[model samples]
Target: MLNVKSKLQTCLLYFYFLGGTLIIEFNNDEILFLEGETGVVGIIKVAYENKMLFIATQNNEEIVQFLEKDDLIAVSNFKKDKRAIRSQAYLTREENSPLVILNKEHPSTKRLETVLSVGDRVCLNCNITPGTHPEQDVLCSCDSLSGLEISKTETGIKLNQYFDKYTIEKF
Candidate 1:
């Protein structure tokens, strides 16, 4: 019995070690992609407790991906998407999460290009509730060399710099 218990403990420890110890921190508005994907898969919207909410684009439709901390890591020989984890829980929750389509092209692509070109930093802080048309959202101001603050609401997107606010109707 003692030998059996010892073996079980050793196995558990081995699995734990194999799981991975590297922890990743995600900031709001940060883009995440799968291992070999070039297009934007999702953007970090909120990080709470041990979970994160992503404004993800799937098949050109907007959806939400709620993932736990362990989801980001690889545990077995199975191939895993880098930032997009495919855990059992993730699969279970997929059916309940509804997909919302953005009428126009998402602004992230253009904004990212502009930011990369001018060397400006853009970040977002949002609060979203699943299954709501326009979830309660708050995008805090960004501090960058250019002092540009950009935020996206359901119907409109806003950009504010030095007290001048620019609002685009949509997209």
Candidate 2:
């Protein structure tokens, strides 16, 4: 009995070291990804593909891909169309739209919110303001968020919070 228990413990430890951490749980229509968004809430997956991430909620799914590792400042979801579009049909439609903001605190939930808020323009890459007192660069509307100066990249907006620096692709 002692040997059996020891072997079991060893096996479990081995799996943990091997990254067999599929710490995903599902409840009804909700799926939770552990250690998600700033350790606040778990991440719910709406869709995924090779080299891509798609998160969703009740309405839409935001699609994004990996760029450079360092350029990635944080990943959050906002319940709004961060992009502006010129469409007469959309302008004529009157609806109450609520914005959901995702941060590190609740990564999973925020990711799901972002997925559901997918549109033509979604904020992906972020950066630190870099000064005596630094702040986060806002999610830009530009196609890519990589460059030396924040203004040069696109979307001159800056966020008021710090973001997660983990690379999803590294996982």
Give each model a TM-score: 0.18, 0.19
* Runs off by more than 4 Å, candidate 2: 1-28, 33-39, 47-171
Highest lDDT, which number? 1
Model 1: lDDT of residue 60? 54
- Global fold similarity of model 1 (TM-score): 0.18
Pairs with backbone N, CA or C atoms under 3 Å apart (clashes), candidate 1: none
lDDT of 2 by residue, 122-147 (tens): 23332421111112233321222222
lDDT of 2: 0.22
The candidate 2 region of ten consecutive residues with least summed lDDT is 8-17
The candidate scoring highest on TM-score is 2
